[model samples]
Target chain A: MQQIINFFIKNSTKLLFLLLLVISFGLIIQTHTFHQSSFISSANGVTGYVYENVNNFKEYMHLKTENDALVLENAYLKSIAYNNTSVKDSVEIKNLMPAERQEYSIIVAKVIRNTFNTKENYLTIKGGDKQGIQSDMGVINSNGVIGIIEKTSKNYSTVQSILNVKSKINAKIKGSNHFGTLQWDGKNTGYVNLSDIPRLAEIYKGDTIVTGGISKIFPENIPIGVIEKAYTNETSNYFTISVRLFNDMTNLGYIYVIKNKDIEEINQLEAETKDE
Target chain B: MNSVAFSNIARFIALLIAQILIFNNIDLFGFINPFPYILFIILFPTDNNKPIFYLASFTLGIIVDMFENSGGIHAAASLILAFARPSILKFSFGISYQYHNLNIIKKVTKDIFTSLEVFGYITISVVIHHIVLFGLEFFRFNFIWEILLRTILTTVTTLLTCILILYLIKPSKK
Candidate 1:
């Protein structure tokens, strides 16, 4: 009614501000870690669909670069399959006595948007649900592991970039067998920090880091990075080791997202054991 | 009800399309993502009711959310900027500047204080948006330092991109 209009006109700015503030705060709360509302994920779907197409076009632009990566990785993989058994032996060999080994299928896909500079860095891949791409598939470049697939639509998937704080990969030193978790400081592009390496172990600089194979997420022996610096912190028992990542995470064009065929089985077993 | 209002709406839709679809998806340098859709907010018709303006900004953010499928982070961030716009205006400019329906063109070219105030408002909003968006995305306080660095660098690039677009269009600044 005219009364409503008059009332609105009287305190329009204040009311509008309050309304927006409420909606925004609602969204923030809805998106907050404490509250896992379905709204944010649904909105991500809309945003995802739109970006999906745009990523398609932009990914096309990087076709040549991605093509180069695919070709190179293919050649290297082919050589490993045919000639280099010793190098490949360590990766394929499984330890029955140890934790479950995940068998992963690596598929080469183009990177559309690989934003490493941002705190919550994400990488978009050309493959998606149609390609059998699923969430939690490990993403890696030629030199090392990069990220994990967080979401999947029809023809595209978004990988939670290694730069993301939410992302972690179980990793360890190649020879020393010092196991730790690799996580980004959310700062540097090519550098991430290794946490939980026991202080008692004699750690050294320049040690090559590889996936720990502890969890069934990634296959063991996948290269992650090289230790740039190692120092024990007084505050914590874990040695804080800086890793200079082998893959140029910032310039990634094409990466192979590895799907571990055994993850479900292993997870099922783990869940059963934990429940017991 | 002038066609200019409709034209502005169309412009907003088009720019947003270009921004999320074209600009944001680009891996220009890995970490540097410069979203230019905020220009829509800076260019929104000021003749409408303030609450309606907030709704419009929220809708704009919803559109972005729909495409990114990131829940309501964009809407959340845009609404915050829209809410903060008035306070930013008051704080940056003197008491006199708040009273009049200032001319957008004159504010840009003739008034240096107006220009600075406008720029200042945008810079703060951009920073605030990134902080909230990234912070919520992580959903944790453990990576605070990484979040800070990313916010600062991305904000710098976004600010530069905003200024570049503004200078290019040279829209009558309000």
Candidate 2:
């Protein structure tokens, strides 16, 4: 027993380092696995509070630009509202009527902290469980698709920005049923790669891309980006296309968190099918 | 001794706040993030209380990770840096590192260390930190080029910023 004590005393510094290293690696695993229980995320209260105060101060600097964006968005929304026949012709009107029945609702939130330089970027916004924001909800600003919420505390949530290398979203070319997976290469902040797009689908450099909506997270046909480049690879038959995002992700301000009301129903039905 | 401990605590908090608020947001030349916060680990006393130094480094890394929303990559890198500090000091300071009271910042201000020794120390430390940080972040051998590019770019940026900070806050000669 004394020998073991002596061994520990002799190597305590190394032991302590190994112990801390193990804990840090465990945290990395937990965080990467998409588990919701991790404690060290920005969604936690103390960091969230600090970011909120900083955001409150920083918001003043961007007030003029923010107002200009709001006015532009308001004009666009008003144009849609005035064109009654055009609004009725859209797919959203069809979904709102009978079968789908308003499955998605938007909750307004302010971006408290945003980072895009890292390989895995995240945004902390000023709404959480208290504001009906939850994990895995789609987040977007007025311009276009932004990201998905990954964690939430009492008054804040952290979003897995589309710029993150780990981010994968279902996207489709506008006006066609062809679907692809949107992912970031951690290279340019303004671009994302859309893969698994079949070879036969017609595409152009400026063709618009929109959300596929196959998942319960985002509504269908929300604008994502325009194709910046596309080419077929020798290794695979599918085309790898580069998309330029509509939103200037580096300059985000306010955003909307989408809550899908039919998520529980869809998940239960899928689980039941899998079990069968 | 108490005042030394207190000043260390103050420096820790100050560097962390500066990192999370200003440095992280700088977005220099559009993507180079200067993480001078490792200065906490760099400037820590090289005397006794080795275990406390390791713990403090881990705590600083974890807190920075919390603010950045990166899972423990910062913690792992900072811990590695802290564990490797003694060898780094020995290599940079040569024979002078045998003295327990050797202070890099003080010695630099007092001209005990030539600018090359100080530069080498900061360069080695910052490069190691960035390599470990970006390596775990990319987490793929195929991204070795990306990792190397980022490591070099961020190291240069961080080294310049750290040296400037060292000059700004070097302790006065008694």
Candidate 3:
């Protein structure tokens, strides 16, 4: 027993090194597999506070661009409001039906820290559970889709950017019902790849890609990007198309976190179906 | 000794700010981030308490990882480098490193070794750090090419930046 103690004392440094390595590897595995790097994430109070201060100081430089985007979005929203008023007048009685109400809510937020260079990129944005932000909510800008909220702290959240290799959002051609998965290959900041798009669908360069209805997280027909290139190998029945995102993901400021009001019901239904 | 402790603490804070604020934002070629932050592990005084070195390195790495949202890749890589630093020092400096008085940055300032040895030491340290970093990040054999490409490109940038910073902060030859 004394020899064992002596041995441990002799190799304590090596043992400590191995123990720390194990802890770090444990963190890596936990983060990658379960997406639960909560306490260590930048969304925590201290990092969030730091990023917020930096962003507050830096936010002025982006005001011109942010205002322009807001203006464009305002114009679009105004147009929609006008159209909706006309439709409401045409079907005043139909508007009373609870089943036809809007099912998504938008929570406006500003991105404090954004990184697109990493293999698995994440964005730290202002506002979190305090503002009703939650994990799995879809984040978007006036331009297009951004990413899903992966983890949320009380006052901040981290978004899994669409540029992340782990990100796979359900998307489809603007006019077609055929669906594909939009993913990043960790190569280009300007583009992402849309795969699993079957060959039977007539596709062309410049074809617009948008979020499909299949996802409960995002509303159907939310613009994603335009197809820059599409091709297929002889062995495969799918066409892999490259999409050019409208949002210059490298520079982001204001964004909207989408909350699906019917998500609980939809998820419960899906889970029940799976069990059956 | 007190000054050494103070400077080490100051370096820890200064490098963290430089890395998190300045270097992290500089993503050349859309992917390569110059990680001069590892200079902390590299330039930490030799013959210091080993367990304290390990813990300090891990803390620095984990903080960087938290900011970067890269899980524990940085911590793991930094720990490995910290664990292997003695061997690396020995390899670079030879028998001279065994002495308690050896300080790497001070030696560089004193011109005790050729530039080649300095370059070699930094390169080896940076390469090992980045390989484990990008390799664990991608975490797949299929991404071996991507891993290598990122490691090489990032290492060159990091090495250049680290050397520049080293010279910029080297103690005056009194």
Candidate 4:
């Protein structure tokens, strides 16, 4: 026993290093596998509560700025509502009967907790299941698509912000029919990358980008950004385009959760196709 | 209770509040968010009991997890830190971590080595927390490179933050 103890004492440093390495590696594997990280989902739910409380105070600090921005956005949208001249043809109206050319619904919610720092940014809105918000519900600011609902609790729901790397939306270059997948590049919160646009298309810097009606996450032709730069890749068929994101992801406050009455059918059809 | 106990509690609460509120909002270069809360974990006096140390760190970490919205990531990381801390302390003192001899912080020890050791251990553990966090949030192998980059960047930012916080949360003499 004494000899064993002596040997153990001498080799302890190597053992400690191995132990920490193993623990960390195990965490990496567990974290990498989705099945193992469900623990994280429940834990995030807990954080959901904590941020909900903390943001109550924190959100107030940004209230004046948010309120001012909200007012400006409200006025801007009001202008769009009254005058539809500059509004292009692609902005789809969901509730449009033949009698109504354009129709829309807007639900108001305040940003409780906003974390744009992480790669997967999240916004905790002061609305929830009871407030008619559910998972996969589309969210937007006056700028463009903010995010979709990732998790929902009783009084609050978390939106996957446009700044998140997990967020992807189909968008097209303004004036050109070519569309590409838009995703956050994980470098700048205010910018995202538009990939898969055909290189042959008439593309240049400063051209506007807008959402394609390809997905239910956002409506068609919603203004996304202006092309910051565009270049062809080794895979020569596509243009790797960079876009200056429309929304100021860092300072998101008041948002509208756009519940499309037809989204259920849209997602259902996609899910069936995916299964097939 | 001793003044140090109160100070420890105060430090814990202050660090938690700062991390969840202030640092959470900061995103420089996108992947970095330095967690200063572990400064509280690092500053607990060597004379403090191991159980209390573990309990305090775990509780603080759990509270943080509640805010990060990632399940068990914070708690698991804190517990991992707590579990590994004694071993780290043992390595610092160049001795075994038996309970009876635990208060032997009076002995002259490796000051520089200990600080770096603690920093390395805590940084690695926090990286574990974040890797679990971002990885789960984006469940795909395609994001492996991004996740690793984010963890590294965030760890660097957090370490700078931890060092700055250490300057503020000084150990009070009994």
* TM-score of predicted chain A against the true chain A, for each candidate: 0.76, 0.93, 0.93, 0.74
List per-prediction Cα lDDT, in the order shown: 0.71, 0.88, 0.89, 0.68
C-alpha TM-score for every candidate? 0.76, 0.93, 0.93, 0.71
User: Which candidate tops lDDT?
Assistant: 3
Q: Where in model 1 is the C-alpha error above 4 Å?
A: A1-75, A82-102, B21-35, B62-73, B87-167, B170-174
Where does model 2 sit among the CAPRI classes?
medium
TM-score between predicted and true chain B, model 3? 0.93
What are the runs in model 2 whose C-alpha is more than 4 Å off?
Answer: A33-38, A85-100, B112-115, B171-174
lDDT of 2 at B169: 76
The RMSD (Cα, Å) of candidate 4 is 7.0
List model 3 lDDT by residue over B1-174, tens digit each: 699888889999999999988898787877788999999998888876999899999999999999998889999999999988888888887867767588666765445235677667778899999999998999989889989999999999998898788778867767
TM-score of chain B of each: 0.84, 0.91, 0.93, 0.71
Candidate 1, residues B1-174: lDDT per residue as tens digits?
777678678867887877776666555556556777876766554454567678878888777764454556777677777766666656655555545775443354244335677777677778877887677656567877767876787788888877776666554536
| lDDT value for model 4 | 0.68
Tell me which of candidates 3 and 4 scores higher on DockQ.
3
lDDT for A236 (candidate 4): 75
Candidate 3 positional error at A50, Å: 1.0
Q: Rank all candidate structures by their DockQ, best first, as comma-separated numbers.
A: 2, 3, 1, 4
